[model samples]
Target chain A: MVEYKDGADFLSPDPIETQVLQGSQDSEGVELMVKKNNDRLTGWVSYTLSRSMVLINGLYEEQKVNGGVPYPSNFDRPHSFNLVANYRISRRLSFSSNIVYSTGRPVTLPVAAYYAEGRPFLLYSARNAYRIPDYFRIDLSVNLEGNLKFKKVAHSFWMLNVYNLTGRSNAYSVFYEVEDGAINGYQLSVFARPIITLSWNFKFGNYNSN
Target chain B: MNIQHTYKYTVTKLFPGGVRPKMHLWVVLIIALAVNSCIEPYFADIGDEPELISIEGSIIKGLSRQEIVISRTTSLGNPVFEPVKGCLVSVMDELNNEFVFDETYNGIYTLEIDQSSLVEGRNYKMVVVTPGGAHYESEYEILESSVPVDSVYYDIEPSLDPVNGIEADGLQFYVDLLAPDTVSRYFRWKITETYEYTSAGPIHYYYMDLSFEPVVPDDIWGLYRCWKTDELEDIFLTSTLNLATNEKKQIPLNYVSTLNDRLKIRYSLLVHQYALDEEAYNYFMQNKIATEGSGGLYTRQPQQPITNIYNVDDASERVLGYFWTSEMTSRRIFVSKLPELDVKDYFYPLEIFNMEDHGAGPFPMAIMEEDGVRITGSPICFDCTRRGGTTERPDFWE
Candidate 1:
């Protein structure tokens, strides 16, 4: 199925703190998925290819972003692949795993520098012309169920989850800042390390009978 | 028990903490998720942008010297423009006649052609040979006859400038054109304005000798008054195809603020009209839209306007600019002061000054006066030549 969406946002740069920029985003994409359910190994794989662009022409020509060209939207990732699998090891234990891969998000980068009015300024490439590194992550989790008993008032299951099993530092964003009359680029990753979580899911009133 | 009551009780029992309190946590999580969205800088490898040749010129009938400019586009970061020099340029008609152009300035070429040789309704084209041995030519353009302007006049009207907002007193200039009898015509106009202005102060008396004793009155040589002329840069195009009548009335050319110095004294405007073919008209119309449509919420996609000129050797090589032949008609009008229009009180008051020959040198000092007293300031103020215009009158000046 084909889909179309429109969105708007308010952006403010540091120099013009009071100046709020109004930008519009347009996105169109298609998705496809294949699933094998009710089998020994239940799994589903999906892929999506899409393009999104943002036009921030601003109220005046001077405030135009990306020289008024429609740049790639922040969420625009042309290609994405996702695989989710769940396999039952036994009646009491089950395993689930997920793998995700997608093209990196768009970012505006500086291509060159110049001096104007005795101050150094960076000339940026077209808005969103470059992207962060491609993103890939894998997650795994195991579910352990308690033994069934007719007299028990409640039964519980424990889940052990490992987020970002490989601890890959997928870049959340790449940023540039002017320092010492020069522009410097840096990458920032929100989830830079693996995380583990343990949780108990409970059912009341002899729910195991079903 | 009622189903609604049962559901409500179950929800309350499921969350010992009231639903409202638990919902607050969910709201916070959502807000955090939204705030966590980030923006970063990235380097895009767009590769090398091709530098293409840019040619700008026109072939007008009856012109002694036709001028053309050739330059190359630069990369995004560099603001400097590179002009193409030492190129062979020529204009040729279908009758095998050729007019060659000589490079006068950087990237600028000029040709002196016989005005009698330019015939109306004859097809003409421009050819250029680059220093790198590339040949370029434009499509043949027929010189169309132009209609004379019926009148050029100005009216005081209230108007709004998109950039500066409502201007209550504006002098709007308009052109009236007589309709062609049979064929539909496209019209393009160019406006040139010349205005007289004076410097701050007119030097009335000066010391003829270096000695402090001799002061002589200077003769009135019209040194205070000068004139400056400039051509308008905006593109203006109108066509009679959509109008019911062949005659177009009061087509607006430009507007001047009542407070503007151009209207303070005497102003003259020269309006040139050209008749264009359908293709040339379309090209100019698109050019007008592209330039005038900027600084607004709606903007046309940034693309080069298709030019008639193309590379003769390599069809893939992109060329910029248009070459077309058109018959042109011109009209001039002079405007004096209008007492009927109400304008804001604005004036540059002159200051009186005294000069002394101190043994070291001669120095001028400002002489203060009462608030209502009017006195001329220094020569820099009243001298017209300081403003970059000559005291000599133009041949066509009325």
Candidate 2:
């Protein structure tokens, strides 16, 4: 169930309404980061541990307990981590990249059934029935900038590889409805794309100001 | 002063005849930028914390009790609020009398009371304590609503000189109630239809002034029977009215008809007590599943029964109906006709029909004045493909 301060205004967020900003929950997961300072290099190795859940008490009051139920939606990931690095190629160019790996999200699997109008209502039998494969990916980007003939105009070209090493990563697992009683699960994968952008900018306003 | 110095060393090699010059531009670009650029490292991860919670719900006015709802903010569309497991809740009146409510469902608590307990002038408030010792409170006023009733009218018109010699008619009932103040309330109504047909054949047609969604007859033949033939107990529509007053302003009476005939209509209303706030209104709207739940949840309009008017007769079709006289009075007036049409003079090339796909018989019925006309003001065969045998009858009162 969703709450709004004025009425279901989807545009605004209610302070009382908490939301998932980004990334899934995981416990003690590792991440790799690398950066270049001038001719020097810097990097980091980190870890995370957490979980979250969501419920629709407004619609199905039966599932609410205590004040509400701790359904499977709350446990995204208990822990996670990242790794990064950077390298200087020349005065006009530099290379930077990061690698991330985390455990998959939890999915509810329906098992038992309750009778409704002679049809069995599929009940979510277990809290977290299945998990997708682990997630790991690398991203690399190069930055280049120079002054052109046009006054105040600077040209820049960037090449970004969202997934540098690993081709694809799966975030969550999904299962299709059985037409004749065959249990099957569908795997979801992380999006990977290589982006090339070339841009030129003219600065009329002050580049730096109070 | 910390002074930085720059230095360069060059090595020259002589060839057989002339010296060759080599420039290392790549090395110069990278070394130049490395002298000024720097990177910062910062990363921190935090876990989830229990979010805040808020409560809302309704209590029937008579005993001043309704289901109470407590919800919380979560990232998922289906956010979880605490379940009603073992929480304790009470309604406090002005005299400090506390009435305990039961946790009927997960986050719902219900209180049962009689008419005398929920006096209109009394003030009330609900207080709840969570099992973990968190406290929540909300206040409410015992607001009363008057059953509202609007004008009622009918649609009667004559079919162009061909089909049935009698006029076709339809009925429309309308009502608009206002609750300028308060949060929520429940509404219910019971309507009855009385009509007489000219033929004894199976009831082939039925029409009602339904909102957007038309409620068709379960037993097609039942369309011809009168409210008197069947038990009165079986002739009503029941629904919950937990919407805001601004939302319940208009309610329309949809009709069900079998054939071209005259009809008499009557209905009664029952209003439950409760109030709604902006929070409750938003929750209902955002989470509202159907189009019917969105805009004004009620529908009321002028109903034209007879397909035509100029070729029809003037009949008293005395249709008697009343709204909740307990709270407000309702009145209705029957009209002879709505807008009429002259189909003979309209221009058209010819109508096409597909007998197999639509299961329809002929195009002649498409010319009926009630059937909708194309942009060219000409009628298209109701079943263009006709595979399913469906016929378009704009002339038939929908």
The candidate that wins on DockQ is 1
Predicted structure with the largest TM-score when compared to the true one: 1
Tens digit of lDDT per residue, candidate 2, span A41-138?
55666676555554434343222321233434434665577877776676456677787877767644333222211112223322443454567777
What ranges in model 2 sit over 4 Å off? A1-210, B1-54, B63-65, B69-82, B104-107, B140-174, B178-398
Chain A TM-score, prediction 2 = 0.53
* Candidate 2 overall lDDT versus native: 0.37
**Model 1 segments beyond 4 Å from truth?**
A1-43, A48-80, A85-210, B1-44, B161-166, B182-184, B203-223, B296-298, B344-392
Q: Score the docking of each candidate (DockQ).
A: 0.07, 0.03
What DockQ was computed for model 2?
0.03
Model 1 accuracy (lDDT, Cα): 0.70
Clashes of each: 8, 102
